[model samples]
Target: MAEICCQEAKSPPATVATASASAAAAAAAVASSVMDRRRRRLEMKRFRLATDLEESAAEYARAGKRQRLQRTASGSPPCPGAAAPAEAETVDPDRCPRYGVSSVCGRRREMEDAVSVRPDFLTGSSSSRSHFFGVFDGHGCSHVATTCQDLMHEAVAEEHEKAAAAAGSGDEEIPWKEVMERSFARLDERAASWATSRSSEEPACRCEQKMPSRCDHVGSTAVVAVVSPTHLVVGNAGDSRAVLSRAGAPVALSVDHKPDRPDELERIQAAGGRVIYWDGARVLGVLAMSRAIGDGYLKPFVTAEPEVTVTERSDADECLILASDGLWDVVTNEMACDVVRACFRSNGPPEPASGEGTSSSGKAVSRAESDKACSDAAMLLAKLALARRSADNVSVVVVDLRRGL
Candidate 1:
């Protein structure tokens, strides 16, 4: 019994267990550090790639080789030869930072059209910033379209500032809806003056000879959109349109203000423009519905007041499409939405965690992929419009709220 007790007195040392625990913790720390480093490197690489792509796009645009106007159909009237108004040519790309792709092949006439704006706002609250995107389709002349492109956003911003100041609102905050409305009004007014000034400066200009001899008579259709974090506000004057895709379906947001609708025909006739039916057709062969801006000479025949619509997007709203008549002439709102959705599904952006907030999470999921998808989609639309033999200049602006980055 004494010998058995002495043998059992010997026990294993405790050092081996302590050493094993310490080694496991050290390995874990090393693995975590390695993962963190990898994540940081990936993020940096993504940022650099996006920046380089954006810069390259800008340089391509500035080089002037990328802007080739689309041609008109074989028998279409030649595009008006007037130069884009002075202010129009000076559009500052820095103020608007958008990413897009455009192509124009003027079949019978020079394409005098413009599409898209930079997502960056020139001036606004840093916390509640907004993005501007638009498509201006010029028919009789490019001056009106170009002028609107150069100055429309600025006009909106100015009116917004004045309204906010008058109402004593806080810094950089303005009612975007009101601002958009007033800006459209202001744009018509400013365009009228600009056209008049150009006409006066060059009495012999060909654009004057083509229409009712007033600057307003030589007009282009406008479809503009201002996108905010919580809302999307669209304004349309003329036949241009703004459409949206919600949950893989198309929903038209802007009414096409044409000369044929009963109300529009009555208004056009009342304003002094002939809303006559050519042969058996109504509204002088014009298929558009409602009223529009510009067409100054037609002002008495057509009203400058635009139909405004403000929509609060649901969680399902996926994309917005703004286009000139060229696109609408060929593709319906539903078709446009379908194309965008297909592109999104096929070449969609990446999903990467950015921060802890829900908004950031959404942004990370939507905009993390390559911007080439957006550009490719827009180009595809324009190409399709052309293929459908859309006679007018084609311009399209596609805004992917989910993947705009």
Candidate 2:
């Protein structure tokens, strides 16, 4: 895309400027419309993906598994008649119960954002009913983000299993906060190793285009939320964020790590990395985040130590939202919460799954609107960001805590 700005360039006193206020406004409006269309296209594509995931969820229901989001009012008790969620429901340990949507928007031809939703994410009899959701935003390339999407959860699971084993059998609790910290540290080393191994196989060049240093400079920001019946834990490294809806209000679950922040700035300077102001405060004017995975070249300066927080689940905790910076760059926490609450509330009651009946072995199944609250909220948030002209790829994940996914 060509650079087209509404602001008129300074003209010499001798020349009458052709650019007018009305014309600039018209151009700006056109730009916004075009970006909106791009967002719509990406959203349409994500809807198709959501449709597939919906089918996957239906399969679980067909297999004697009911994954429904029980609607409970803010700070209210469970439905007066419905049976309350068991303190320890013996889940299949393989049922994944969450869904999300992702979109590419505005000026970027290729997207570098990746997201994941894993339920029953941990293995063995000890680890049960835990789900993980995340969004990864990449700079320089999508490889790092894609790689993290594929491997980070596995690392977390491995760490989780270790913690579970150490705690011993029979209803012992695991400290997920410590697990998140250790798992993130392990992923940093693993991502670095992945970049190194791939470079060793490729032919070397010094053009900075085909050279190994290209990937060495690429990195991705990660924000993850771990949800279970009793606990909600969030871990973040970079600008991606997680937010929870508490009684229809938005509460930030993770903090954005930026080079401009005092603590982040201090860390960079201590590591002999300059935080130069170039469009914005960047570590050596190259990276915007102070901590992230990958970016082998920026190691020591850009650590992958995630800030982890753990909280007990409460009735006020309605749902959770996770997204990349593209969404946050345009959407405020309050606006996002309001939009989601409205979208979800719009759906009244779930109808029976409608479609031609098919065996559980079949690949496809039908879905209803009532069960699609999270997916709908996620798609709308991405569109909202794009409509606001966020100039980056957008990704969103919405997990229904009431559903225990």
Candidate 3:
């Protein structure tokens, strides 16, 4: 009987084995489907980003073409004028003219800081000898900061040419100081227009909706330096600053347009803006500094005119540092100079040396490396501020003139 049973069992396949094989195949199919779905999702994300980038480039092209047409019709050089649209709202790599500009964002928010550096032209022509550098620190949002970064240099270059023509001076004879002043005004106007256009556009993402009027209130602090073969002209609005390091010491070129300053306070009051003092020494009630771009809501109480200063670069002038408040908050001007001096001592590269500085081998950190350091530093500072319970978005930019010069 046992032998008969064994024969029966062997004669047909067991139901359990068949069921297990089918289940295993089903699980594998499901996993494959899931992996395919994930890949498709990632592809869609990349496609959307690419589309947005393309659209931004198209917008810039259209804007540039329009400016060229207007210039031709007016028979004027393409200085930024009333006809030029506001600066572009997005950051595009094609727009970057300089070689090294390190940027980093904070942990709690998107990066709103922008920087650019153009080496002095060496064509042996009059205009080729001038070097230009600038920093824009955005508050409320990044649109204004990014726009200024892209357009400020071009605007300055155009204005310099226009000023030369107005004075019947050749490019070589153009007055750098006058060019800086006029260019700054033009930058403000263009930035304002850009902000307006951005505000008028319909919201496409949650970020836009949350900050519906970001463009309107999203003003930026600008500090620009024009380094010529003979002198340096600096223009400042808001707190972003440009400092000169002469013989390894610090010399401030731009004034901080804080509401607490007597001049700034008076200007704000004259413009119908009140400065709210907190705890006797702190300023809390004012919306912004005495000067800024955008902040249309505070336009009635603030001015867009920038304060300009020009100085001859003496033999003592070794380096210049242009930075946003982020670096200033954590490091003083003296300290910054010392840091750079230390880096020089270590035979580091010409850029500002921080913990991010390079080794003694002389190979400076990569752009990505510096960028990550900056981002990490800003985030760490923000966290520290939070630990101390401070509320404000942090942004920073550092420009080292020794290397570029």
Best by lDDT: 2
Task: State how far residue 153 of model 2 sits from its true place (Å).
Answer: 1.2
Residues 241-301, candidate 3: write the lDDT tens digits: 7777788789999888888899777766676667776633222353546677667767766
Off by over 4 Å in 2: 1-98, 169-172, 203-210, 349-367, 403-405
lDDT per residue for candidate 1 within 167-278, as digits (tens), equals 6754234566577777777777877887777664545445766743466555667778877666677878778888888877788888777666667777767756666566
lDDT of 2 by residue, 269-297 (tens): 88988998889888888888899988888
lDDT of 1 at 270: 75
| Per-model lDDT | 0.63, 0.71, 0.60
Q: If both were scored by lDDT, which would come out higher, candidate 1 or candidate 3?
A: 1
Quality of model 1 by C-alpha lDDT: 0.63
Better of 1 and 2 by TM-score: 2
Q: Output the worst ten-in-a-row residue range by lDDT, candidate 3.
A: 90-99
